[model samples]
Target: MTSGYLWLKAIHLVFVASWFAALFYLPRIFVNLATVPADSHAERERLLLMGRKLYRFGNLLMLIGLALGLWLWLGWGAGRFAGTGWLHAKLLLVVGAIGYQHVCRAHLRRFERLENTRTHRWFRVFNEVTVLLFAAIVILAVVKPF
Candidate 1:
């Protein structure tokens, strides 16, 4: 691989890791938000602010990661990853991650509106989706097991 390719790959990995960190934590925050007493307005508002900011930051990281990934896949390494099932699977998982993030953002909006209808238990289950998706992505990328 060219040094330029290596650099892009490294940057892509960094942004992905950052994005996943936020993805992993944000739902836990939602779980906490779900349990806040109706009268704990202060804590509820604080969690809502943090969730909004984290979602925006995560979105930025996703964009950077996607751009760098495209650069690696096409601009710098065209034809290199072609016909790889693992790459396809990884891409699908990445898309799923993005969709999951969108769902979280929607939940955040609901919380902001004081209209969240899901229980803390539901969020706890929902949060595990990230872990499963991340694990599958990593395994597909590293193992390339078809």
Candidate 2:
């Protein structure tokens, strides 16, 4: 409840929210990439470049956010909550979010290699997964309903 704790929490929330923005949009980019006409090389390349840049930016944000969160938990004594069921569940979902980000990278690679076989509709569905994950994480953190 100290000022330092509040500041760290605020910064951590900022970076995490920024990272999620990238997560939410990247799949929509994938949907567009998937639907790009096979002959539209220029368009595909443009989207790929955007995706690559966004992915890198998102990675940086995620790293900073996670580092700050770790500091808040361990250094700032939020570790008091460590053994609680809600904290455990929240951590698991964080792991899932990381995995989801990497999965997006894999899809981007496939698209870059012109090996993507999924439809735009599939990518649309995939995009919703991030939303669900974010919602669950927020609920776990705020509600802490064990």
User: What TM-score does structure 1 among the candidates reach?
Assistant: 0.95
Kindly list the per-residue Cα lDDT of model 1 for residues 16-71, writing each as its tens digit: 98999999999999999999999999999899889989999999999999888887
- Pick out the ten consecutive residues of candidate 2 with the lowest summed lDDT: 133-142
Number of the top TM-score candidate: 2
Stretches of model 1 off by over 4 angstroms after superposition: none
Residue range 28-116, candidate 2, lDDT tens digits: 99999998998999999999999999999999999999999999999999999988999999999999999999999999999989999
RMSD for all candidates, in order, please. 1.1, 0.6
Q: Give me the displacement of residue 118 in model 2, in angstroms.
A: 0.7
TM-score (all chains, Cα) for each model: 0.95, 0.98
